[model samples]
Target: MVFRSPYPDVELPDVPLHELLFSDLGERADRVALVDGRTGASLTYGRLAGAVDRLAAALAERGVGKGDVVGILSPNTPYYAVAFHGILRAGATATTVNALYTADEIADQLSDAGAKMLFTVSALLPTAAPGAAGAGVTDVVVLDRADGYPDLAGLLGSTGPVPEVAIDPAEDVAVLPYSSGTTGRAKGVMLTHRNLVANIVQCAPLLEIGPDTRILAVLPFFHIYGMQVLMNNGLRVGATVVTMPRFDLPEFLRVMQDHRTDRVYIAPPLAVALAKHPLVDQYDLSGVRTVFSGAAPLDVDLAAAVARRLGCRVSQGYGMTEMSPVSHAIPDGRDDIPVGTVGVIAPNVECRFVDPATGEDVGVGERGELWCRGPNVMKGYLNNPDATAATLDAEGWLRTGDVAVIDDRGLVTIVDRVKELIKYKGYQVPPAELEALLLTHPGIADAAVVGVRDEEGEEVPKAFVVGQPGGSLDAEAVMAFVAERVAPHKKVRVVEFIDAIPKSAAGKILRKDLRAREAR
Candidate 1:
């Protein structure tokens, strides 16, 4: 039986994302829209909207228009918002690249997304230039001034009218953010303008941000959770977002106190910090009203403990990169929602529990893989029809590889993830990607990666490596090798040397056996 969201459906506007987000900014012209937490700089709604227009005109002047794919590789910054909306306003698709990604890593995404234009910060030119060269991207623009690069500041000087471009909100892809859906290497998730607009409306009831509300954005915009939930949603509701380029607990807490931030969206690791870290007591977090955790599961005990200490309600939501990244969230003003359970489905979402082995729908309270269908669901994975078909059915229901159980009250409690993707502080670390990297080392003979919980009870990637005979490769060597190749979060935190990796007869690595060994 398919379960539908209990909440009433929200009215989805039939327009492009930029129009939907900035339509009524006239009244909110002077309202503070974004605050750079590091520099203490702020951008008003009027300036943000004007920048979007000018940037759109500038990008269009460089021959960017509909069907063009532009890459954005930067941390969460006020200018990131300008570039993001400006690309969409130009009727081009924005493919957000992780700032932490290495040169080769970012190049793979740029090549796959078929990006023609790229925007990045000057600090990242080392990696960005090489990556752009590899991807055959000639138009590399920087958000800041740098030698031999077109700066966004110069573009804003144009003050020319943005060229008019036709867009089909339902058909035209707006953003392409890569993710390892269910399993395997990262593929671009094709999100339409309608998909994003609907998700913002669907998340409206759960996220009660207003003009007066201030949000602390420690989450990166490259990820869907921060892109949609924090940045886009905050702007859609006219809330002030304080952007943090990096996560430093000291800086995070300081910004929350200094800005008097009201709503904070975080991952479980940071939530655990609030619950146990001594530094949290030093800062005044009393102004914070709501704490919502997503990107990974949150422990009920930890959630309750932090809520009691901070005197604010703590909540958790379940989502994936495919579902515009959100399908379930505990709505605001609902005191009865259970602490551990990922609350009721979001508005206009329908979910089914299907037995993984039989591929048949299961009854409520039974354990099965969760299947969701919603307006927020991605159209498909870019350039990968096989994966797209495997995940999204003909009828549009998305097969989420999460094993869950739904109670009579419609609250979802995730039991396990059938997918092999590891969640490291809200970042998706694909084992396959890491395994491929490990094999490149001359000393490494074989490797299998799995997630093991650390002392803080947060999941981190751990590698079981088998070294070439007489090579004398150690754990530190293996960890350092991976750290240099991948993003900081995807680094192998723990390494265990083994003679052989347990595998099934079908040649699949038995991750359960490795997890069992870690548990012991």
Candidate 2:
């Protein structure tokens, strides 16, 4: 028994992503499309469209062609969006790399995605140069020109016409984002042009962002949530987006007050800051009308606190990287959804709750794995057919390893995640990846990683390590060893020395046993 969306199906376009987003920009050409919060810099819609065109022409002149993959490794900036759309305009796939990744990590993803051209900022050249070199990327364009790099300004000087290439929206992959699906190391998730456009259409009604709306984009655009929800959807609706390169609490609030930001899309961590931080009182946030939280479960109390403090509507959504990142969201202007629930299924989405043990659909109000079918779902994982087959089934249903229950009103409340991926402040911290790094330490004999809730009710990665015989390995050393290799969010915050890591007969780490020990 499948549960359908409460909203009517939305009509999706069959054109390329670049076309779908910029086709109607002529009407609002003079409006501010993007703003840099720190520098007070701005980019108008007219300039953005012209920049995209010229950049595409330049990329084509440089030999970027259809089906080629280009990499963008920058934070939220005005040029980031231009580069993103420019790559698509040139009939190429944009593989946005996480700006926080180490050189080795970045190189691994670029190599796996087969990226030929790499675009980055001057500040990240230390890692970006090495990463691009290791990946054998030939063309390197730096937005802020450094020695031995092609300047982005030079790339935009081309007066040549934009490439007029035919695109099959459904079959052509547009963006490749990496995700640790269910359980494994990170693999590239192939999102096609149709997959991205369909999600924007499906979510537009619920978002209802108009020209008057000002979106505060503090979330990193490298993540799927920000890329689709805030950037793409906000642009599709012609809303003004204020981009913050990093999330500084004081600056975030100041930007909202200064820009009169009407909409904010955030994760639970930011929600906590808004609800409890004293600096929130320092700014005039009365202009903020709606707040949409996602990436992790937002506590009911935290949601209420934020709503009460800001005197605005607060809502949460549920999604995964494989689903173009949003399958359920609280409909705009809705006041009926429970505070803790993630709200109704998104438009044009069908979902079911399947009991893993029985392999059957669960009855209403019973917790089970959430399985959804939607046009927003990714085509597959890049170059990993077995992982793709395991995630997306034969019938086109993508099994989201999240345990949830749908109420009688078609509202979904996620109770837990069946997958072992640890979400720390909305960033995915795969335990297996961390454990692999831990084992490389000579002092560590074996290790297992699990997420433990902090005092603020947020998950933090914790590691239990077994030291080598007669080796004196302290908790600090184990924590630092993993922190150096992975991103900050994936860093192990708590380390416990153990005799042996609990494993099943098949030698798989029994994380549940570790979680229970932490609970005790």
Candidate 3:
């Protein structure tokens, strides 16, 4: 695993996971490590290192050890990354929980992962505390809180440096990012230290990150996209990261102007802001040299329009959570690629498209399921061998469940998802979960949820419900009911009361029929 220098033949260090942050760049101890958006707080590399060490010591004192699952439910703040890296430094696995998830949703994830300790923000403590307790969580620590939970600042200041714990980079799971794949309930994706570290190294060349690079960190760290591209890559290259707690278009543009952001890694909806939003004219965007969009497909016209307006290069990438969230990355200054293509396979990654019906490789320029074999692929689904076997083949090629076309130029265009998961603003929503929840409603006899493109051209969940015999149910009431139970992103935007839900002979919901009906 040595990267040989082409010019001077220099040998890189083969350090373990914990050593990556401490070793990589020289003279970086004095650089700014993270900038907090909420209170304009910042921590230099030296201060951040001290905090991580102390937090590691505190967790160790609490009997947290290697392979232990530590759940983190917070937004995009400085404490999020500090706690995340600290968990890894303590030789424990970090399981990221969506802060907006309902108590029952959070509880299901915590119980499934067997998380022993939870780290969350004070504002979200009400939801997470009870959820953690319900899942048998023993210890709860709140960040920036004065009471109710252990204070993060006090723990960091009081504890001493922790002794290094032995870790197997290949075998020890480092992150647990939940995804619903193509069907069923959400399952934790087991990402080992090697899986993540390899992805960092693989994406470094494409990102072209350097000490002078300044990235706008607005994406949620709980997701794999931000975890790899923004946090991990920024630290490795000694770049300045300007954080945002949430996405506000005007504030995002203001931060770019204030910080002179050189590069922005954004989702497709953000691209819409750059393309059609009127407020974009108020801010100066000359500082941004490149904009990379991922997590969902970027509309070709919108991407080009954004590039024209900002006078900067814009590109789209494609990947899944199972692939460490990055499989293909289009280089920044290249508009020569065919429209709608997500560019080529990243360095050290092998991609092959196979026919879905028959397990045979498709010819170049053909459409099929995209399969990836690389170190960036997850080790497997946590505690779900059935899913692991279905996802990863014996030869180790991970089935992406995404339909794509690979052209002669090596560029890949993702056409559709074979899986039943829906992407609402880059967050995955499993229809099966919603369907199961809908059945719990007394008035609902049966339900089938499907994704339909809204006026903005973004996927929104639309549920078709069958009322119980002689039961009175309306679309607005059903929609409102689900809205209150789930996170805002998972809410059913459109609902229709139907006499019956169309299903196959085997009892699988016919989502295609629903999508076709919406198209009409």
Q: Per-model C-alpha lDDT, please?
A: 0.87, 0.86, 0.79
Q: Judging by lDDT against the true structure, name the best candidate.
A: 1
Off by over 4 Å in 3: 1-14, 180-182, 420-520
- What does candidate 2's lDDT look like per residue over 298-389, in tens digits? 76766888999999999988887899988998888888887688988999999999987798999788978899999999999999999889
Q: Write the per-residue lDDT of candidate 3 for residues 382-461, one digit (tens) a residue.
A: 88999899989998988888777777677888866667678999987877567756766768767788998899999999
Q: Kindly list the per-residue Cα lDDT of model 1 for residues 1-520, writing each as its tens digit.
A: 9898888888999999999988788678899999999888999999999999999999888889999999999988999999999999999999999887789988999999999999999999999999999999989999988999999999888766797999999999999999832245789999999999999999988767788999999888888888999999999989999999988899999999999998998876576568766788999989999999887666676688789989998998989888988899888888899867899999999999998879998887898899999899999999999999999999999998888889999899876666777989997777756875776676865678999999999999999998877888889999999999898989999999998876422123667788889778
Candidate 2 weakest lDDT stretch, 10 residues: 502-511
Q: How close is candidate 3 to the true structure, as a TM-score?
A: 0.79
Per-candidate TM equals: 0.82, 0.82, 0.79
- Candidate 2 ranges with C-alpha deviation above 4 Å: 180-182, 420-520
Model 2's TM-score against the true structure? 0.82
User: Candidate 1: worst 10 consecutive residues by lDDT?
Assistant: 501-510
